[model samples]
Target: MKAKSESLTAKQTIFYLLLSILLNSSGNGLTVSLNMGSALWTASSVNLSHLLNFDLKPLLVIYGVIVVITNTLLLGRIEPRRIINNFLFMVPFGYLVGWTSQLFNLLPLNQLSTPLKMLLDCFGILMVSAACSIYQRVNILLHPNDDFMQIIRFKFFHGNSTVAMWVSFVPPIIVSIICIIISRQIYAINVGTAFSLLFQGSLIGLADKIIFPSLKHHGVEQAVN
Candidate 1:
């Protein structure tokens, strides 16, 4: 019975993981197409691409590598399986974000008024937050950034999601500032970015309670094993 329960939980986790990825990718697509602003890490990537004259895709991988390193440090030990899972997550997530971005570009969101665009931007962030809650609870494969946030939330902040998110944002904020100093212009800092900074963590916490309340956070030890 115990083995059967564990097997069922594993299947459920995979289902939720894929669903969360789709939601996250769609949210990213909406934010990118609306063009008001992007999530802070994404904005930082854009800024770095412009300032360093590197292609966006390669720069993103470099950023992911850095985050992976940071997560390893936070963990206080190298967990090779967890590290590999984080990178593996990027493979499908990257392609999905690209395809979804193209799909959202076909929408009439851009033609909407400024107020409406801002509203949609916030909605996009909400979707991302909801996705975060689901996958973090699932706690299997994770994007490097999400893994960093999860480590902070559970390990450092005593499971305070909002505080962990704010702490996790520091690196991207510093990168954005550096790019501003060098380039003298912003790449993707606007209303949506502001929304994410202010409410994303809170929304994720909220989503955890309301989105799938039965799906308790899995044991970290069990997840990696």
Candidate 2:
């Protein structure tokens, strides 16, 4: 449906993918360093990481693998190419998470006041939302979590993406609650997590509205000329 030149080259695709990974990881770093929670999936992953005394990178990998496996089971076949590409994307993404976590640790956010920390949490959420929006626009290989959500939306939700997305949060929310009960502490499920869960969808949609139309307009102008 689109021209080949409109498609990203391998190098460009890799660049966008890495940039998305960096932005996402940076946001995760900010949230962790500020002792704030992130999105539902991130909160669940953080809880598991803390509970098991494992680093975030390994937990992220395991989560990605689980999502991929779930997707394969649901779809009734393994798409080897897609799976390999997703795995390749995950490796660098996991590394960036660790790298950025360390980078944020060097910051003095720990000394900041409660209000300032909360503000930073919101900023971090924005970064993550923007990163996801960019990645979606790139139209390259998707992260397993995103792919799984899409599959669920199409297969089970009658293609109602909005409802499917909301339903997808249920599992992560349940996991976070169980982790809290087991740990006897609210590890990372804080006000930031609530904010992200409530507002991220709207933010992403807003980003799409802004990004897609501008690209379309540019394409139209070029064609007319």
Candidate 3:
């Protein structure tokens, strides 16, 4: 009876979480679209588009290598379902996130404007975190980018002892420093970007805590157990 109760509870939680994820992702998409529209309407009046020409290859290459390496390490150990799920979330989000960042730079505002910067940053962070939550709730694979750190925490460090969120930035943080050294790119590694990253890590974590419990209740925990 007790076991059955827990299972039921988990299912309920998962349903609610997934719904929230969907709504949040929709909001993020709409926000991005509207922002782009605003940019297009004002294109002729502003010169901020130059910021979009930033040479971000080095940063992207370094980050991509980390994700690929981590995914390779956990290829066979983790469920393939989680991998696929992550890919679905990360790819679309990655594309938009990149585009959003570029558009963000093109917005007719000063990055040096402290208040505006923070406001724009909050919006970015909220979007990332929201997508991360949705991705995890859909019964899909964990995104490859986060796979390595999450595996280490859950497998080696004991997840409850240390959350994967804190460690998620290690690879990127290192890469960001390298980016700063090689270029004068304003978006190289700013607070706005960091805030967005923190959301990405935290929301997936929220999903894990919320959705996985339900899965475990439904018997998905058998493999991890």
Candidate 4:
């Protein structure tokens, strides 16, 4: 029974992880549809994709590799199984994002007024933040990008997750700026990018206080136990 419980917990954890990935990808799709910038890392990836003439999927895979390597170096160990699982999960995540992007593109979002577009951008940020909160609360295998942030928080920032999350945006923001300068176009760093940088950390904290607490009471903890 103890072994069975652990197995069930593991399965539940994977389910939450997948759901979080889906939500994150959907939020990303919405961000793309709004013609607004995405979170820093994704925005950087988009710029890199355009600059390199490579498809977003392949670039994401390469970026994931770099994230995994960085995370391993920071943690001083390689959890091969977890890293492989993350990559496997990312395969479907990529497809989901593609499908979601197509669906959002078919919508009338592009025709909405500027104010409405800003509202939609806020909604997208909420979705991404909530997904991140769920992923962190599950406390299972983390995506490499998120894992890197968490490691930095714990190792360097005195476990200040919020500060760490914001700081993680800096490098990507610099890259996005460079891309914009070189191309003479504001490709992916826009108002939405600024909004995400300013507010996403607080939103994630709010989710932790409100959303994650409710989830814990509603069988999530049972699964973990």
Which candidate number maximizes TM-score? Answer: 1
Instruction: Please identify model 1 stretches exceeding 4 Å from their true place.
Output: 1-10, 221-225
lDDT of each: 0.81, 0.70, 0.43, 0.71
Error of 2 at 213 (Å): 4.4
Give model 1's TM-score versus the native structure: 0.90
Instruction: Judge candidate 1 against the unseen true structure and give its global Cα lDDT, from 0 to 1.
Output: 0.81
- Check candidate 2 and list the clashing pairs: none
Of the two candidates 2 and 4, the one with more favorable lDDT, higher being better, is 4
Clashing pairs in 1: none
Best by lDDT: 1
Per-candidate TM-scores read: 0.90, 0.83, 0.54, 0.85
Residue lDDT tens for model 4, 1-225: 111122236677777777788888899778866867777777887787777778776677777778878777766777677688668755666566657777999999889998888778778878888887778666455667766665665567754657978887877777777877787666556677878888887777688678746443122322222
Predicted structure 2, TM vs. truth:
0.83
Q: Per-residue error at 159 for model 2, in Å?
A: 6.8
lDDT for 223 in candidate 3 is 23
User: What shift in Å separates residue 45 of candidate 3 from its native position after superposition?
Assistant: 29
Q: Which residue pairs in model 3 clash with each other?
A: 82-141, 82-142, 83-141, 85-141, 86-141
Q: TM-score winner between 2 and 4, please give it.
A: 4
